[model samples]
Target chain A: MALAEPKTTSQTLWIERVPPIWWALMLFLLTMPAWANDFFLFQVMGWTFILGMIALSLMFLAGYGGMVSLIQMSVAAMAGYMVAIFGASGMGDISMGLPWWLNIPIAIIIAAIFGTLVGALAVRTEGIYTIMITLAIAAAFFYFTRQNYTIFNGYSGFNLVVPPSLFGVDWRQPMPFYYLTLGCAAICYAAVIYVSRAPFGLTLQGVRDNPRRMAALGFNVTAHRIAAYTFASVIAAIGGILLVWQNAQIAPGTAGIPAVIDILVIAVVGGITRPIGPFIGALIYVLLRTFSPDVLLAFGLSGERFKLLIGLGFLAIVFFSPDGVLGLWERWRTRRSRERDPLTGEQK
Target chain B: MTLVNTTTAADRLGSVSSGNALELRSVTKMFGALAAIRDITLTVRSGERRAVLGSNGAGKTTLFNCVTGDFLPTGGTIRLFGEDVTRFPAYERIRRGLRRTYQISLLFNGLTVADNVYLACRGVSRGRFSFIRPRENDALLTRSDELIEAVHLTPWRDTDVSNLSYGQQRQLEIALALAGAPRLILFDEPAAGLSPTERAELVSILNGLPGHIGYIIIEHDMDVALRVAESVTMMHNGTVFKEGTPEEIENDQEVQELYLGDGHE
Candidate 1:
């Protein structure tokens, strides 16, 4: 591991060489719970990371593949529902009482399969049509889960969905759960980054950029798009598992239209093109959701109206910089780099 | 056991069946009431350099599209090598070593020149389905760099297609066409937007390519068309009007009166 292989530009962009900023951020996240109280650790930062993971999955699809999938939350929520139903948690006569080993993989696999199916149906469509098809499917799934009581347990969703005990520790406890979420997020982040540099990911980006050109160059464009959805589904499914653990519940609202769209907002707000942008967007969103209520109250507005600020923020970001916060950062960096070295065009 | 033996023998024969690189027999394409291409019977032998020369709206581009499977011919059979690929999609044609450049450069403008060529290389390579292997490590990607050098775009190799000059994009476009290890390549209006110098460079590049690469060039520039192609087919009003060597077509009184012999030439 110590002997480094010389890397290409794409390899350098990947997880091969972890940046100092990322290292500092990871260290801070790892040690945060020790100093921070339960509310900050579990409710604030932990939930933020879970949402961030969900958004990151969306980012992976839209950013690299030029595919905007609205069914990402549906995939995640499907996994959450799987955890509730399969692993000894659902209400009377609903739970399957399967082992954790079976349930977890089954949840992820099913979500991946569902995502691929959605991709297959939507892959041929472009732009607005793709968005509409995915949105419609997500809405249909939401209603199906909400109305179907026999299997899904209906409007009053399943509760007491606890994580299994492993290594003599109650995995759902605050510190452990936080670590579990952080670890999964880190692995998923690395995997997404790694895959973006991988052959499949690069080809996918080509397909996204020019599907016709890609197809003419001998690539199976539909297959690549479907495969991207499958990869994105796995990321979302893992986040779903963490979400059910964090909240100890699963509901149709988990996959509802607003939640699904929120994932897209987080991705776009952070920077749809950058891997870390979705998480940063998620952080900004979570911070707003957490404290905007108080800020609204001081302005003699209802706490529920905090959502207005979020909406406005989204509009402002879209209007000013369509690429999101990351785009702004990139433009600024380029200008600075140009000022520093006109001849070389080197960036810091 | 007999079936297995027959299959192996057939596969061996199939690898190099007949020397014809491309065969289009009475191919026609109709769009609504208009026939875009009409009974285009053309055969390109292995290592053949041919030109499809005509005025604008001669259906040369349409013929390229039909042959490349951008759109299926309404009438006849299109064959690649020995295989009947009339019903094959564009991508399938590409997989079978049939490649073409567009009249308008259809490149991934957001991606780098290296990335563009890398994609072209990856498309035909056996590891096209590899999910985890980084493209940077692919032996084919290294080969794509050589293609960049071949087209004289090495200095702009890492630059984005959108940022490149029109001439450079044209160069990358040709590089991409060559990246697929194609046995047959259709160059559609390769000199469309190029300066005279760039046009000469393109002609030189085409000249330098391996002779085994069967090239069907759709060129408006008679100088370039005459220089690169040994034989020429002149199309007028969606039909082949004249077919002969560059000199024969140039000197033919009928061709001069009807099309190429006009002031445009």
Candidate 2:
């Protein structure tokens, strides 16, 4: 069927169409950390935020730009490597060293340039070709980092980079770092929301839904897609820098093809339809990856098989909810709300 | 065989009275062995109401594509407001005050009817690439309201376009094209798939178009065409078959034999 407008005036503006349940969920996330232990808070929650940020960039590209880019993680890894190479602790210790301030901005700029170039090439193709092109580029970058010890520091990768500090606060600490990460994530999330509502964002959606018509309406579809990729890359790069600071290292393994695929899984599991889905999916993955072995050991199972269990869980979730966990939650909430007010119930 | 034969001045095309909004010179589009449009020449003057009538494969849509920059013509010159825009991109054409509506309604289905109109209006009212705020200025909203009023869609303004009936969706598409306040507008089969009453309403809307905005409408219905258009260009076999007023074309024996007469058999 041809695309039709959904009911309701405000629903058209996706940024302003937040349901009450989402707002409640967001509040719950902010206030209910009292139950989280230190390990759960620092390692599980922290990694979730970082991975989620990275996945959100892909979500934006896929959901809005209608372009699925598999190299988002590789772009993030590039940012991580930049931080490792330029941060005070990483200096010649990793590769070619540079000042922290100078390198940080330069790395981001370089990532944006690379992303724009990648987008210009990838946007020329569509569907599976787009995926393959991005994957190929990611694979090439991975091999470049793995074999080039002179620049990338070889298979062991770069380490010893630390988060910078200011105003008498050590940002790398559990609480301080969590807040820093949260702040950055929030800003990136807001930026995505803002761009999606902008004219460029609207045009991208038009192109995605119907390119032939958009072309007739006088839009350059290729240019819009490239701009979308470049914008998403900026967000992914920021997440990469944050991840490097959190882990104090960067490695070729961090951006391998398999790792890039895992990012896609996170985005799909959480919900590609919305920005927050990445965070939710990341939380689930980090929790299982961190605790699955211990939980299995208690049951007399080998920790070596933990990955198999996570894979099963991933399959189960996708089979049950193709739109992801968030879609399921949305459906369930709508059902419950309808049950409460049969007379006034309105289905979306 | 010929009917209401007129002097060359009528076909001379360019004159200062209305001034040329768009001019096509020897435009031809070829796809390997086939020429989709061949040596087509036409002039669209400001405030002209022109209908492009053609059977299937007459190159009506392809000609629209060339004018709108969907594809560059294989050879020719296209001018907008007397300036050469033959090589300009589609978006640039829009930026320079040209806009179009599709045969099938192209409203943003997820957005409200008002939002769809507002977006197009914002494109024109607010400078292109301005990212200052979520909604454009209230002045722009006021203008959009005026446009919504003009298109007779104020009642469904708040409805999501996806939820609107097919007829309403078409109206909304016209509203969207009008939102750009374009100097030239192209309507592709605007009356296709409409109910009889809806068709009449659409024709009335087209006929009532403001004097400042020139329109090029593609229509299959000759009755509606003759009523709304002051001039008509009929196409056959990928080229202009006849160019004249509705009555002159109707009285022409060759045109009638090819289409409205024995051709109907």
Give me the runs in candidate 1 sitting further than 4 Å from their true place.
A1-17, A90-92, A338-348, B1-16, B135-137, B260-265
TM-score of each: 0.91, 0.88
Q: Write the per-residue lDDT of candidate 1 for residues A83-139, one digit (tens) a residue.
A: 889887847479888999999999999989998999999988988998999999999
Error of 2 at B136 (Å): 6.7
Which segments of candidate 2 are over 4 A away from where they belong? A1-35, A90-102, A215-218, A296-301, A337-348, B1-18, B124-130, B263-265
lDDT for each residue of candidate 2 in B47-116, tens digit (9 for 90 to 100): 7889999888999999998988888999999988777889988766775667788877877787677667
TM-score of chain A, cand. 1: 0.92
Query: Model 2 misses residue B59 by how many Å?
Result: 1.8
Predicted structure with the largest TM-score when compared to the true one: 1
Q: Which has the greatest DockQ?
A: 1
**What's the TM-score, to 2 decimals, of chain B in model 1?**
0.91
Docking class of 2: acceptable
